[model samples]
Target: MTLRADAVGHAFDGEPVFSNVSLAVDPGEVVAVIGPSGAGKTTLLRFLALFERPDEGTVSFDGTDVWDAPESDRLGLRRRVGIVFQEAGLFDADVARNVEYGLRVRRPWSERLGDELAGLLGRNGTNGAVREALDLVGLADDADRSAASLSGGEAQRVSFARAVAYEPDVLLLDEPTSDLDPRNTAVIEDAVDRACDRGIGAVLATHDMNQARRVADRVAVLLDGGVIEVGPAERVFGSPDDERARKFVAGELVY
Candidate 1:
């Protein structure tokens, strides 16, 4: 499977964010997008998640143009793409339930109704998927804890768990571990690797150049409203064709 952006551009309230941007990911590959703040990394992921339409270009899935598809088809495609925003937007519920939210939403309405009926009969419990997701983020022992009681790092891990619970074909993460400690950051990175091992493609947007160099199979450098360079991670970091990308990778460029 493939999720791709072709010369895509977006504008916010008549202000252009980026233009002529192109990127793509296939199953089992991790593509990292790195840039300064407000360089449109999140906006680009939004387009990939089908939350926003680009003002000038195309976002496609498996070679089919996403926006041109019917709403039903688009919704189906959207469900197949999972996203973790920069913020941890957890619900006011138990940790397991927060992680289970994505799985529940992706379920068929009829299946959800059956679950509701089961809950009425006192048969409700978190599923194996929820437990597995929690385990992936080292939250298996915290399943029963209230989300509100968790620390910021724990909350972020829960958010990551929730996004990956459904095993979406495409994963989009925006600075997923920006606030976590090293241990927690390692956990998140390992989980990402496992997801890719399962043949799930991912797009990671991060500011940590070292993390990008470590985890990304390929890298895209976004600068001055567009992608200045993108290629295999080594080439992009070691010997970028664009002077801006070279400086950015060398720690000489600052936002």
Candidate 2:
């Protein structure tokens, strides 16, 4: 399913964060959001995920108005949309339990959820689906380990697994590789590719221009809480349309 925000706008405490922001993400496409801090990247993502309401505009998922739906309907909408926050979102429970949380939440009637997730995690086989997700993020052998036991990178990978386990149509990522080493970064990069292969639309927010160049099929540069330029990744980075994008991409501005 495709996710889109039409003429989105938001404000907080009488201050305008963003207005008239519009973007669409098609299934199997990877879109990267790049901008300095306080550029409304997080706000926009939260709006798309239906975590926050935009004062104006609408968020549509698969041609349905997700934000305009009732609270009861939003829960089902969330099942098809998964979010990976900058801070790893693992729980204190076991690794398998954390990944199975979304599945159980959406399908409470399933009696074999535990066994199903265990099998999916590859508890009995060498290629458990959970393990594959972890492996994709370079945490190949940490199933039974506690969430607190993982490093920043490992925890992030686990969070990725949890999101992937839901088989969402739209995957939203916020600074997914902010605290990772080179190897783990590569794992995240690969995971993004795999998600696209599975026809999952993705929107990633990052400060890393190089990473965006490597992964984003399309890039949107935000400044002062509005999209200054959005285009093919190569063109956006190689020939920025605005000074904010140019300065940030060139490392002249730090925000």
Scored by lDDT, the top model is: 1
lDDT tens digits, residue span 1-255, model 1 = 899999999888998899999999999999999999999999999899999899999999989999999998898899989888878999999998888788778754345457566466331444677888888888999989999999888888899899888889999999998988998889889889998999999999999999998899999999999999999999999999999999998989767
TM-score of each: 0.93, 0.88
- The local distance difference test score of each candidate is 0.89, 0.82
Best by TM-score: 1
In candidate 1, stretches whose alpha carbon ends up further than 4 angstroms from where it belongs are 109-126
Question: Which stretches of model 2 miss by more than 4 angstroms?
Answer: 107-129
TM-score for candidate 1: 0.93
How many pairs of residues collide in model 2?
1
Expressed as tens digits, the lDDT of each residue in 95-207 for candidate 2 is 76676666556444243455666456443432355666666666667778888888888788888888886578899999989878988888888998998898999999999
Model 2's C-alpha root-mean-square deviation from the true structure amounts to 3.6
Residue 179 in model 1: shift from native, Å? 1.5
